[model samples]
Target: MSKIKISNAVKKYGSNTVISGLNLDIRDGELFTLLGPSGCGKTTLLRMIAGFNSIEGGDFYFNERRINDIDPSRRNIGMVFQNYAIFPHMTVRQNVEFGLKNRKIPKSQVTAEAQRFLKLMQIDQYADRLPENLSGGQQQRVALARALAIRPDVLLMDEPLSNLDAKLRLEMRQAIRDIQKEVGITTVYVTHDQEEAMSISDTIAVMKDGVIQHLGTPKDIYQRPRNLFVATFIGRTNVLEGEYRDGKLRLDQGYLLQNGMWDKIGDQPLKVSVRPEEIVIADGETGLRGTVLDSIYLGLNTHYIIRLSGGEKIELIQESTMEELIPAGTAVNLMVKKEKINLFTGDGSRNLLRGEAS
Candidate 1:
């Protein structure tokens, strides 16, 4: 197990800077996931850690030693790719043993190690099958087994489950998590899938435009995103534009976000996120009167899109089989607590609402 650290690391391609002086510490024996949309430079960061990509500036350390100059093979970092990178000509056992053989490890020790991980990954039964003879999931298991056979200190995965079906992806997630726990190797996984990262990671770093926006537990990133970009990117968010005026908030359409606890600033335009589940849709209340424009039935929740008095739309979610199902075009009430409303300044950095979760 190892602690991987990146301090002010910068990577440039041509004149474009893909990553700029980023700093992060991945704890020892923990599964840390880098999550973001495509072209966010998540994969580039992963490659830099594995020594597959050079660090043009700053330093990367494995434990206490600086490894910016260490070769990929000597760094003792194992990498698994998006595609099942198994040799089609080699059997599962041969594939797993290939790395050890190249390093001139004892044949007996290599065989034992290969067999051990093949069983651990549950691919021992197909040890003799060629890559094409095995299923996609099985091939991935072989790739994982191969990567783990050498028992590297750090395991790096770049969207390893992207090629598999959804069901297989779920299975691989559990398998990967379980294997990492059993072996206790420090792991860094990269993926664009939020659910996948939130499921298996001990910690997550959400990146945007080659920078780390927020690094925390899945719950932290989802519940208390630091910025509007994070709140809208990491999960679902209903953005409401409003202005703070006289201890109250006026929406785009003149509907007030009433709050008894907060001191409203005078005429400060702000964007607030009202999570769908936090907004309660009900009938017979004079709360922001709106006409229901659409009712979207999500398996366990129904989402109602309502047009307020000033023709602005607000969405709210009702529990499964809500007894008060108002038809579209019917009048409804949108009730949201003040705390659930997240207020952000125009620049999306500083939060205008004091003492509120970021």
Candidate 2:
């Protein structure tokens, strides 16, 4: 395993600067994920680390060694491409053995090492099968085995599960995490899928347009997002515009913030984000009044779209444990858990609820 340090890294194509002066440090044996939408330069950064792309400026280091000019083949990194780039003519064992042979390992040890990773990836039985004959998931396993057979210093994956079916994606993600833990290789994963990154990453860097918007654990990113973009992009949230006054937040829809909900006080407009599950649909006449606009049954939960008296829409997710459904057009009182709300400046420059709890 190796620690990756990128300082003031820049990538440009002529006049277009895709990544601008980015700095990051990935710990040894850590599974770090670069997550963002398309065109956000997450993949660009990953490729730069793998030596597939050149850095316009700045230093890229593995441990204490500077590898800015090293060739990709000599970088000692194993990369798993999105398409599972396995040789169609080579059988699973042969494909895994190719890298060992390229490094000129003895013929006797090549088969043993190849079989080891193949078994680790649970594809030992299919070692003799060609890539064309295997399923997509199986093919992906072969790709992983081949990458691991080299016992690289770092492992890089670029949306490795994007090609599989949904169920297969889940299975492969678990398998990948297990294999990565067992091998303890420093991994850098790039993906646009938020759930995938949250599930498998030790640390996640949410990027946008070429900049990192937020970097933290999955729980921190989801529950205490630092900006409106991070809050909305990471998960489903209800953002209500309101004003901070004295010590309370006064919503435009007439819902006043409970006392001591936040520590800071300002008189500027702010946005409050409440997760769907954090909202409670009150039974009596104690909360803000709203009418149910829509209700969707999703097996595990019932999602309701509630339009407040001021015509603002808020979604509430109710667990289906009781199986009681509220019909549309029904009047309801909505109350949000004050402590669970996230407050951000209207321009999304700061998070007011960053370190304070109710």
Tell me the whole-model lDDT of each prediction, alpha carbons only: 0.86, 0.90
lDDT of 2 by residue, 114-141 (tens): 9899999999999888999999999999
The superposed Cα distance between candidate 1 and the true structure at residue 194, in angstroms, equals 1.6
Model 1 per-residue lDDT tens digits across residues 1-358: 7898889999999899999989999999999999999999999999999888978899999999899998888999888998978899999999999988988999899999999999999999999988888988999999999999988999999999999999999999999999999999999999999999999999999998899998889987777678888788876778877778877887655667776655644567788877878877656654667888888887888888888787667778878784756788887766676676777886677555545444
TM-score of each: 0.91, 0.97
Residue 212 of model 2, lDDT score: 90
